[model samples]
Target: MESEALLSVRDLRIAFAGVEAVRGLSFDVRPREVLALVGESGAGKSLTARALLGMVPEDATTSGTVTLLGDTDLAAQRGLHIALVPQDALSALSPVHPVGDQLAAAVRSVARVSRKEARARAVAALDRVGIPDAARKARAYPHEYSGGMRQRAVIAMATVNEPDVLVADEPTTALDEERRDQVLRVLGEQREALGAALVLVTHDMDVVRDHADRVLVMYAGRLTELGPADAVLGRPRAPYTAGLLASLPEHDAPRRRRLPALPGTPPAPGTLPPGCAFAPRCPLAADLCHREEPEPQEVEGHLVACHHWAELPHPAVDLFQEKQHASS
Candidate 1:
């Protein structure tokens, strides 16, 4: 592991029974960098995050190296340098405990702080995430807080320890428009203050554009593409990636119609598509693309797993820019 990297995942694999959720995944999170994992639901973003934090469900099994600023991979370190906020907000919190209390308990559970200190820390955490009158809010039960507040409370708990790296699974999922912006801003502020590498798992392109320095696009169980946010979002080279972007509603685009999406849902886990997992739905797929997997290839600093990447046009500057603009 490089001293510059706060977290690194290499050849990470995870499975439930015979079905793999993540396969041969590798990535690095440099110190103070924000990496966004963007993909549709069930595309292995959350599962990859869960495996790093050792939070996978009981029926699953995980493997591979997840190194964090040292020779030790997470498989060996047991999340000593990592912390996470899970995907499902509703089930993540304890229903009976006061949200504040539960958050304070998280501090004690992680770092052995005294109750008074933990409560103080808890109040501070809430305040850090933009809760007004944090102490009063802390005293309220989970049921007492509104959905947005609950989400904030969860963030407070996850960030309390100020770990070297933070994994946030859909942090803004439950928020309304105003609250979503607030949540995003809070995360940005928190990242600045904590100086922890943030791994944000989200499907929203706008969030990816606004917050991420780099984007990791996963399809099926594999990491399909990764690059600087501007490069990947601006001119994605993989067909699957291009399809996803083409499908997004571009408010800035001149076109009035919403957008066009690729046909067919994601393939099931145990039975991923034979070749490029996305070959069935990829418009540019060829016979070779359906029978042989593409190894990760580096383009500048970006990584792409596509058999026909060189043949695929740059969507923004070359092929889809006009279409992208009109969609808005």
Candidate 2:
């Protein structure tokens, strides 16, 4: 484990019924930094985030060490040391209980506090997340709160315990653009206030560009690129990362210009390609790429997993554009 890392994940693997969903993965989350885990759906972003909090499903088999502040027992430390903000706020919150009561229960579960103190802390947490009239609003049920408010309350609940790490799985999913930004702002504020490391899992590149200090790009359940946000997003070394960026509609491009899209879907678990799972979809894949899996290695300033990373084009998005043009 790195000396400065708040949480360290090494060789993390999750398999379901002998089918690997998340392959060998390693990373470190430093204190007070946002590390964005990004990839398309079925890339294991959510599974990886859940694993950080020891929340993987019962039937799945997991291997790896997720150490937090020198503690390897994640299940015991969950909520007290690490917390999760699940994707669906409505489902995560109980409709039967008042929001404040739920938060108060969470506080009391971890700390030996009186009901009064717990309620006070819960209200304070709600207020911290900018829930207007938190004292009154916290008394409302999940159904009574608006979508945005429910999301904020979930954030408040996750942070009220003052965990050292927070793993949010697509926190802004299904939210409108304005509401998404607002929720991210609230999440950032809570992270700042708690001085916690955040592992944010989302498919949103725009969110990654705006909020992440570092980006970890996954493909077919394995790391394709990992580096500082600017370096990774701006000059992605891996073809998989480049392809993903190329597919995004550029702001300065013509509104009707078709975006370059990666040709194939991600391979289903248990049916991955022999060498590199992405080789079939990667435009730059060479014979060696098809014959041998590339482990993540330092290239320029980033860790990229690709046999041909050194040969990737400058302004990496052009790599995919040229491929698209050739195919057309």
Candidate 3:
């Protein structure tokens, strides 16, 4: 049976002058689901998320379809029901003004709320995201709060309108571990409270495992793999994905010979590797992988874009024993 997806991004591509940041990427986020667009920085995660919100840079040229509500095109809806928590909270907000007024403005812009009403809603939003003494904090400027508080304030402003989709690009980038967990919990709460789909774009694989219901892995501007979060991370098929999992700093992961890392940097946006974008870095790459770009196709329930996916070996990591070995 088909799932009830809130958005379906089909063949979405983005170009900036001579550079191609996103290349025909496609994915879907079900209503109230947390989908992780997982990748390294400069891997097109934010670009795609911004594309969804119609907030791509002025210098960028875009094509293909980003459909929200399963029918309404993102280009058409633009700002009505989509809100973005950008990568940098400090840069996204105004330093001179109190965070509350900005939150109020966001709410009033989307919904027919008065300034007083919006202020109340803003306080409630701040409170929802675990901001302390939200009413008092509302009067405080963004600079007055610490990095974590400011991040929460950003979340509050974005969700004040009860948007249909929340595009959170590294929402907890500058936060500490405790605050990060709190922010993740607040995202969960916001999802439950508003029944809105959450698209969390983060480079942290740990974050994906902790907060996401599904995962999409991008390599060199193209999606290399996508599946249910647990299944995808637990049993990654693509070599690039396997290497990424191996690179994960897990208490459960063994202290290995050396943590595996993809050798070369991700290709520049304007041009990617000839065949598989990750071929140069993938251990399992064959001659075919170097020449022919693999198309994303379903295998069982997951979608993978590597030709040698099935032939690849499960990475040798004694995870359970590794924890025991660590204690010993």
lDDT of 2 by residue, 47-137 (tens): 9998898889999999988888898888888889999998999999999999999999999988999999999999999999999999999
How many clashing pairs per prediction, in order? Answer: 5, 0, 0
Among all candidates shown, the one with the greatest TM-score: 2
TM-score of model 2 (CA atoms): 0.98
Error of 2 at 157 (Å): 0.3
Whole-model alpha-carbon lDDT for candidate 3: 0.81
Question: Model 3, clash count?
Answer: 0
TM-score of each: 0.90, 0.98, 0.90
Tell me the deviation in Å of residue 310 in model 3: 1.4
Candidate 2, residue 34: CA error in Å? 0.4
RMSD of each: 3.2, 0.9, 4.1
Ranking by lDDT: 2, 3, 1
Report the number of the highest-lDDT candidate: 2
lDDT value, residue 242 of candidate 3: 78
The alpha-carbon lDDT assigned to residue 61 of candidate 2 equals 99
> What is candidate 3's CA lDDT for residue 73?
56
- Backbone clash tally (model 2): 0
Instruction: Single out the weakest 10-residue window by summed lDDT for candidate 2.
Output: 1-10
